[model samples]
Target chain A: MSIGSTIICLLGALFMTSSAFGQAMDAPTDLAGTGYFRDQDTLPGSFRFYQQLPGGESGFWGMGPSRPNLRRSSFKIDAHDDVVYYSPEVRCQKCHEPQTKDLHYLRMGITCVQCHRGQPVAGVYQYYSPLNPIRRHAYVCAKCHEGATPSFASYMVHEPNPIASEAQGRFPLLYYAVWFMLILAGGVFVIFLPYTVFWWIRDLVAKLTRRPSHGS
Target chain B: MAVDRTRLKRFPPVQRLWHLGLLVVFMILSVTGIAWMYFETPWGRGLAEQFGGFTGTLEIHRIAGLVMLAGFVLHLLYMLFKIDWKRFSQSLMGPDSLVFQWIDIKGFFAHLGWVFGLRKYPHFDRWSWWEKFDYWAVWWGLIIVGVTGLMLYNPVLTSDFMPGWLLNVALWVHRIEAVLAMGHIFTIHFTVEHWRPSAFPYNASMFDGSVDLEEARHEHPAWVERLEREGRLEGTLVPPPPVPLRILYFVFGYAIILLGLFLLVFAIANAALLTLF
Candidate 1:
C-alpha cells in the first residue's frame, strides 16, 4: 500500500478501538430500564398496582417481577449476609447453557455474567431469578477465588480467550495451514516455474547451437 | 604483466563447494518448509498428505532444519578460517561502511527517488542496506524459526518444562516469521538480485565465483577500489574463467522444475477435492 493508505488505515484502526472502549464503558450498570424507573411506586408489576394474580401475586405472567430491577431486588433480599457457593466443582457452562437458542445471542456483545451472577451454577440468592436457580455456597466460589496463589483471570474474572473456540478445533486451523500453504506454494510455483524452465532450455539450446554470448 | 591463472585470488575451492552445498540444501529446505507452512493451500496440504500425514511435514521439516543448522555452522567456519577474515568482516559486518550504516535508510529513499527520476542512481558500496538487512534477517530468522521449530516438532520435550500457552506464542511467532522471510525473498531479494535493469537476466557472481569487473566497480565500488589500492587488480574486462557449470545447472534446475511440476499437479487435485467439501 502507499504511505497515505497505511497512515489512513492506522488512524482508522485507532479510532475504532477507542470508540469500542467508549461503548463498553457507556453500558448501563443499573438493571432498571430508563422510563420505568421514574417512580418507585409504579415499578413494573409491583404489589400496589396489580395484586390479582392466580397466586394473589402482582407480577404479570407469574414471572416474578420481570422488571429489570429483579437484580436489585435480589441484592435487597440479601443485604448484610451475602449469598455464596458450596459445590465440589463449579463451571461457567453449568448455568450459562453453553449453547443459546440464537447463534447470534452469545455473539450479540452481551456479557454472560452480567445477568447470570453469583457462583455461576451453584449460587442463588433471594428474588428467585431462574426457575431452578442454584443456591450460593462458599465452596463453589473457592474454585476460582480465595486461593493462596492468584489464579488465572478465567478463574478470578471469567475472561475467556477470544480464540478459544477456534483453538478447540471448532475452526480447523491445521486444515487451513496445511492446505493453504501447499496450494499457495504450488500455485505460485506453477505460475513462475514454466518461465524458469523455458529460460533454462533456451540457454541450453543457445549453448549447443552456436558460440555462446557468455552473458553473465 | 599477465598473471598465471592458478595464483589468481579467487574464492577458495572449499568455500565455493560450501556455498554451492548450502545453496542446494537451503533451497530444497526452503521450498519444502514453505510448502508445509501453506498446507491449507492446494500444494501445501497435498504435499504434506503425500508424505503420509501431518507428521510427514514435521519429519521433512526437521530434516531440512538439520541441514540448515549444518550450513550455518559451516558458514561460520568458512568465515573464521577459509576466507580473509578481515575482508569478510569489513564486507559483511563493518559498521563504519555506508552499506551497514543508518544512512542506507537515505540510500533506500534515494533509490526510490531515482526510480521516479527525482534523484541520481544510488551509488552503493560493498553491500547495500538491503543486502545487510537480508543477512541479518537470515540470522535472526534462523534463531527464531530454528528454536521454535524444534520445540514444536518435539512437544514431549517442550511439555516437560514449558507452559502450554508458550507453545501457542511460539507457533504464532514462527508462522509470522516464515511469512516475513518468504515475502522478503520473493520481492526484495528478487528485485535486488535479478529484477534490476542492469542485472535483469540474473547475477551469476554467486554461481560463477567471479563478478564482471564493471559490475564490481558499479555495484560494489569500495571492493573494486580496495582491490586496486592493494595492487590486486585483475583485468578490467577479462572474460570469466570457464566454470563448466551448465551440466550442474541443468541437473539442479531440472530437479527443481520436476519437483515444482509434481507440486503443481498435486495442488490442482487437492483443490478439486476441497471444492467437493
Candidate 2:
C-alpha cells in the first residue's frame, strides 16, 4: 500500500484500540457480559470490577491470555499456576457464559459495550460498532474475551520467529531455545543474504555490459 | 570453446527424472505448507481454498512429506549400493559423491575472494560447496520436520511415551524448520541457481540432464580436465536433449520460477502491511 494508506490505517487502528470506560449495569433488563465483573465494591471502574473475578472468587489470579493483566503475553497447553492453561486444569472460569444469567439479576459494574465497541475495517473506524460491536480484543477485551484467536498485539510480541503458539512456562528450555534460534537465524540471514544479493546485482550489471562475471 | 562440440551428460537420465519428480513434489509442499502456516491470515486461508480447504491442504502437505521421505530414502539407498563396498569409500572422497571436501572449504573462501575482486574465480568442481550445502540442508529439514510432524500427527500416541512438553518442542522445531526452509529456498537458493548472470532466467541442465560442452568447461573445469586427462571426456559427450523435453523444461522451469518470485514478493508485502495495520 501507499504511505498515505499505511498512515491512515495506523491512525484508524490507534483510534479503534481506544478503551471504552467500563459502564455500570444497574437495570434488571441489562446483560452481564464476559467482561462484566461482580462489583467487589472496590472503586467503580472496569479494572476494579474485573479484578474481583480473578484475585477474588475464581482464586486464579492470571486466567488469561484470556483475561491476564496487560502484562500477560503468552501461554501454552501444558502451562498452569500464575501462567494460563487448559480450561479444566487451570482456569475453568465461564469464558463466555456468565456465572448467573438471570435477566432479573444485574451484576454489571463494567458493561462490555463501554469499551468493546466498533468493528472497523480497511482503515475505517466505527465501521461496525454497536450494531456489530467491533468486539476487537486489541484493547485486551474482545466482545467475549476471545482466547482462541490471537490479536496483532500478540503477534508483535511473537516477532522475528513468529511461531503460531509458543512454549513458555511449560517448557522453559524450548522457550529460551526459541529465542536463541531467533537470534541465530537473524544473524545468519543478515550476514549471508545481502552479500549474495550484492554479488547477483554486480554480476548482472557486468553481464549486461559484456564483461566476464566474477565466480562464473 | 567446446560449444561447437557435443554436450556433456552432467546428469544421467534417471537422475534427471528424479530431479523432475523432486521439483514438482517440493513446489507442492512449499505451497501447501505456507497455506497451513498462515491460515489465520486472509491470504493464507484463500490459498488453502485452492487445495480444497485447511484440512485438504494439510492432507496434501502430509502426503507430499511422505513422498519426499520416500525419495530421500531411495536416494540414500542408491548412494550406498550403487557401487561395491570397496569403491564406496573411495567414491566418498571422489568427485562422484556429493560429500563436502577440504577443497570445498577453500573453494568457498576463494569464490568470496573473486567476488571482492581480490583473486580470480575459484576452480569449479563436479559439485560446488553451496550445492552440497543446499543438498544437506534439505536432508536436515526432512529429518526434523518429518519426525516432528509424525509426533504431532498422533499427539495422544506421542504423549503416551513422550512427555507432553516434548511435543511442544516438536511443534516448535517443526514450525521453525519449515519457515527457515521456505525462506532460504525461495530466496537464496533461487538467487544462486537461477538469478545469477551466468544462469539468468533459468538453468536447463537440471531439466535436460546435460550441460553444453563450453558451459561445462567453464563451470566444472576441474572435472572436465580430469575427464580429458583420463581420456573419458569423449565418452561423456552426447547429443543435446530432445526438443520436446527442452520445450517442456522451459515451460515448467519458468512457471515454477515465476511462482517462487511471486510468492516471495507477496509474503514480504503482506508481512509489512500486517505489522502496520
Candidate 3:
C-alpha cells in the first residue's frame, strides 16, 4: 500500500475504535434484566452524577459496568422485625385512599414531601422514616405547623385520638375556660396590684413626714 | 430586763418559720410554673434558658411542687400533733376561729359599712373575716392544686387508672388554681396583711412573731379585751424586736414584696398583650 493510504486507513481505524468506546459508555444499562436493582435511582436527576454507580455498588464488566442490586446485597430482612417497605413506584393514594378521606393535607392534594423532608420525583420518593432514630415525628410536624400555638400543638400531636376528637367536638369549652380564668385573674390583679402599690407609697410618704395616714 | 409591755406575741417561732418557708417555696413554684406555661414567650424562653432549657425548667417545677407538698404535709402534721385538739375544734366552731362563721357574714357587711363611712371599724378578734377567707382559701387551694399536681407529675402512672382526658383536665385545673392562688396572694392577701396603711411596708409580726401592743389593741380589741379579762396580757408581753432583726426583716420582706409586684405587673401586661393581639 502507498504510505498516504496506509496513514488514512490507520486514522479511520483509530476513529472507529474511539467512536465504539464512546457508544458503549453512552448506552443505558439493562439493570432489571441483569438481576440488579437501583435502590433510589427511579427519580430523575435524583441520582444525577452518580447514576452509573447504581445503588452505590462497585464492579466492572466487559460490556459496560455492572450496576448494584441493593435488594440482594445491602437490604436485609429480620424475622423478628415488623418494618414494611413501600416501593417508590406505589402512589400514596393507592393504599391510603381510605385514611386520606379525612386527612387535611391529603384532601388538599399536598403530597408527603410537603411536610416530610426528602426527594420525591419521577415516580419515586425518599424520606426519613418515623422509625429512624434521628428524626422524630414532632420535628416533621413542626416543619409545617411552626406557627401553631403550644396548646394547639399539644392538642393535635400529644392528645390521643379519642381525646382529640372530644376536644374538637367541644372546642368552645376549652376556649372559654382558658379565657375566663385569664380574665378573672387579670381583673383581680388590676383591681388590687395598683391599689396596694398606691397605698404602700402613700403610707411610706406619711411615715417619712410623720403625718397621720388616711385609713390608718 | 423589763419586758417590753408595748409588744405582744402574735405568731410563735415555728409558725413564723413555716410562713417564711411557704413564701419562698410558693414564689419558686410560681416562677418555674409560669415559665413552663409560657415557654414560647420571650421572658419565659429567657428564664428556661437561664435554668438550662425546657427540661431543666420542668425538673425545677416538679421539685418545687414536691417541696411545697412536703411543707404542706409537715405543716398539717405539726398542727395536728402540736395543737390542742379540743381547743382547736372549739376554736373552729367558736367566735375566735379563723373558719367562716355566720358572724363573718355580719362582719363582712360591717366592714363594708365602715368602708362607706356608715360605721367605725367593726370590732375584730384574732382573725378578721378577710383573714379567715384567706386561710380557708389556701386550704382549699392546696387540696385541689396538690392532687392535680401529683396527677400531672406522673401522667404515665396516672394513665393506668384514669382516662387520658383527665390529664388534660388536671392540667387546666392545676394552671387555673395556680393563677387563682397567685392572684389572691399577690393582691388581696398582700394588701390586707402587708400593704394596708396601718401595716405599710410589711407586717413584721410574721417574722418576729410579735406586734406592737397598742396596734394589736387597735386592730384586735376583742382579743385584747378577752386577754385582759383573763389576766394573760402580761403573760403575752415580749421584748421589742432587736434592731438587726428589724433590718433583716425589712430587707427580705421588701425584696419578696417587690419581686411579687414585678411579677404581677409582668403577668398582667403579658396577658393584656396576648389578649389584644
Candidate 4:
C-alpha cells in the first residue's frame, strides 16, 4: 500500500524471478550409469560398457572397450524370464537423428528412463553380465510395480564419472522458484496492506471534514 | 493525551475482510505449519498423526499457505494504491520509532530497574521496539520459510543447482525458525498485547479498527498529540460509549496460547504413554 512497501514487494518479485531463471539455466549433470568410483584415478577401471546388437546382447566391455561411448552394459538379464529377453533395443535414431543422438546422450546427458519405454521397477534383477560387473547388471523394480516392461538404466557418455545407475532421482528447483516468487509477492502485500488502508481512510476523512491541520 | 475520536476512521470493508481472513487462516496455517516442521519431533508426530498423518497435514498446510499468500498479495496491492510515497517514507525509511532509539534502549535497562521502583515507567509510542522487531522478524521469517519451503516442495527441480546438503540445511533452518517463531509469537507478541498490567486484557484495534480515546492517549500519546496539534482531536465531539472489545481479544488470544500449550502437553503425555505401554 505504501510506496516503500510496494517497492520492497517489487524488489522481492524481481529477486524470485531472477533466482528461478538462474536455476533453470543451470541444470545439474545427471550421473547415472557412469560407474561412480570412489577414487578419481580408478575411474576408467571402475566402468564397463556394452551395446545391444541385432540378434543378442553383447558381452561386458572393459573401461576402454571398443565402444568407449556406450558407458553401460545391461547384459545381466537371465534367459528364463521372457520379459527380460523381449526388451526392445533402443537406438539414437528413435528419439533424435543420428547427429543429435551423440549430442543428447554424450554432450547433454540424460537419465535412464528418458528414452526407455518402461518405468524402472525396484528390487528385481533382470540382466546380469560379469564381464563388466557393475554396468552389465540390470534390475527392473517396475516388473513387480505398476505398468512395468523390462527396464534398464541406460548410460550416457557425458555423465559425471562414478555414477550410480540406480540413484538417478533429483530434487526439483524451478518449482521452488515459481513458489518463491508467489510467496515473496504475498509477503510484500501482507507487510503493507494494513497501514495503507488505515491511512487512506484517515486521510480521506480528514479532507472531507475540512479538518484544520497543525501546520507542523 | 487523548484519542482523537474524530480523526479515527472506520476501517474499510475490504480491510476488515482481509484482516479477518488472514487471522483465521493464519491461525490454522500456523497450527498446521508448526505441525509440518515438527512432523518428526515427538509433538509434531503426535499432531500429524491426530490429523491423519504427515501426508494429510502437509496437504492442509500447503492449501492454507496458498490462501494466506493470496491474502498477502492483495494486501500489498491495496497499500500500493492507498499510501503516498513521500508520507509512507516517514514510517518506512525515517528514523526508527522511539522504541528502537537509544533512549528506549536506556529505558529498557531503566525499566528493569524501575521494576523495583528505582525509575519511572518507560514512555512508549504507537509501536515499541519489540513490536517493530517482531514485525520485521515476521517478514524475514516468512521469506526464509517460504523459500526453503519451495526448495523442499519439489526435490527434482531444486537438485538442479542446490545440493542435497544445502536443501538439508534449508530444512534445518526452516524447522528451527518455525519453532523459534512460534515461541516468540506466543510469548513475546502475545504478552505485549495481553499480559501487561494496565492493558492486561488485550487490544482489539486489529479487529474492530478503533481504539477508545483513553486508550489512544495512554497507548499512543504522540499520535494523540499529532491529532491535537492538527485540531482534529475531536475537541468538540462527545466520545463514544466504552466498548470492552479488548476483553474479547484477551479471551481469544489466551485461548489460543492455552490450546497450543495444551496440544503440546497432550502430545508429550501421549508420547510418554506410548513409550510406557
Which candidate should be chosen as best, given DockQ against the real structure?
2
Provide the TM-score of chain A alone for each candidate, in the order shown.
0.20, 0.23, 0.25, 0.24
State which candidate, 1 or 3, has the greater TM-score.
3
Worst 10 residues of 2 chain A by lDDT: A150-159
The residue pairs in collision within model 2 are A20-A115, A64-A67, A64-A68, A118-A134, A119-A134
Q: How does candidate 2 score on lDDT?
A: 0.60
Per-residue alpha-carbon lDDT of candidate 4 for residues B81-146, written as tens digits (9 for 90 to 100): 765576775655443332256655764564344334354434554554455665567567667766
Question: All models: lDDT?
Answer: 0.48, 0.60, 0.61, 0.47
Q: Which CAPRI tier for candidate 1? A: incorrect
Cα error, residue B100 of model 4, in Å, equals: 6.0
Q: After TM-score superposition, what is the CA distance of residue B197 in candidate 2 from its true location, in Å? A: 1.4
Reference-based TM-score of each model: 0.49, 0.64, 0.62, 0.50
Tens digits of per-residue lDDT for model 1 on A112-157? Answer: 4444444432112333332111211122323333331111111111
In model 3, the clashing pairs are: none
Ranking by lDDT: 3, 2, 1, 4
Instruction: Flag regions of model 1 displaced more than 4 Å.
Output: A1-216, B1-19, B38-42, B77-99, B102-106, B235-239, B250-277
Q: Where's the lowest-lDDT run of ten residues in candidate 1 chain B?
A: B3-12
Give the higher-lDDT candidate: 1 or 4: 1
lDDT of 3: 0.61
Query: For this target, which candidate reaches the highest lDDT against the unseen true structure?
Result: 3
